[model samples]
Target: MAELYSKARTKWACRRGMLELDILLEPFVDEAYDQLSEQDKLVFQRLLEVEDPDLFAWFMGHEACPYPELDAMVKFVLDRVRA
Candidate 1:
């Protein structure tokens, strides 16, 4: 029950208002989030706290995420989606 709730909350957080962010984040949360380590999962949650525009820029390659941990996680998510 707790795990399900956590996943549900995470999924909810993944839903940014922008369609592009929704497409990338929703599917990644569904498919890949479960595979993450606990620390990595925390990083993902932190990523969700980032503003949509920054996330869009990071995901679209318009700008690099300045934080290394978040940047690495962004690349990891992108690579998984690409694969």
Candidate 2:
């Protein structure tokens, strides 16, 4: 079956108030989101539903993830950023 989400849709969702988060999220959404498994796409959608401050905390490494799915996704994004 086809995925429920599109890269276009996810790209829009990745826009954030914090430029740091935007820099991290938008590239990953562009280059890697389509490569993600369906389950990870669901996890990413859940991650976007989280507040910017909370997402910033996790992305900035000031706080850790309470959910493993989110943590893994965060790592995946970060890895791409570093590469």
Candidate 3:
């Protein structure tokens, strides 16, 4: 799934068309998918459902990120991309 997501990101970046956040997150999102434990997965799911200002802070690694929330998810997502 990680490899698939990597491929998807590559395709999206190399191709010329509209791209969505969900598509960009597809790869890393699944990295910790099953590994997140049930409770964490639920938290992650809710995190995915949100796009609040808090997300921006977390994405930038600012404010130390809130608990088991989008900050961690963004870090995971960025790690995959940076890899």
Index of the highest-lDDT prediction: 1
Q: Give every collision pair in model 1.
A: none
Give the C-alpha miss distance for residue 28 in model 1, angstroms: 0.6
User: Global lDDT for candidate 1?
Assistant: 0.89
Deviation from truth (RMSD, Å), model 3: 7.6
Predicted structure 3: clash tally: 0
Q: How accurate is candidate 2 locally (lDDT)?
A: 0.87
lDDT of each: 0.89, 0.87, 0.52
Tens digit of per-residue lDDT, candidate 1, span 1-73: 3463377899998878899988998889889988998888888888999999999999999999999999999
Give the better candidate number (2 or 3) by TM-score: 2
Candidate 2 lDDT, 1-83, residue by residue in tens:
24446777888888988898899999988888878889888888889999999999999999999999899889888998789
- Comparing 1 with 2 on lDDT, the higher-scoring candidate is 1
RMSD of each: 2.3, 1.6, 7.6
Q: Tell me the tens digit of each residue's lDDT in model 3 across 1-83.
A: 34433433433432322234544455545454545556555555555555544554565566666565666666666777568
Candidate 1 accuracy as TM-score: 0.92
Q: Is candidate 1 or candidate 2 better by TM-score?
A: 1
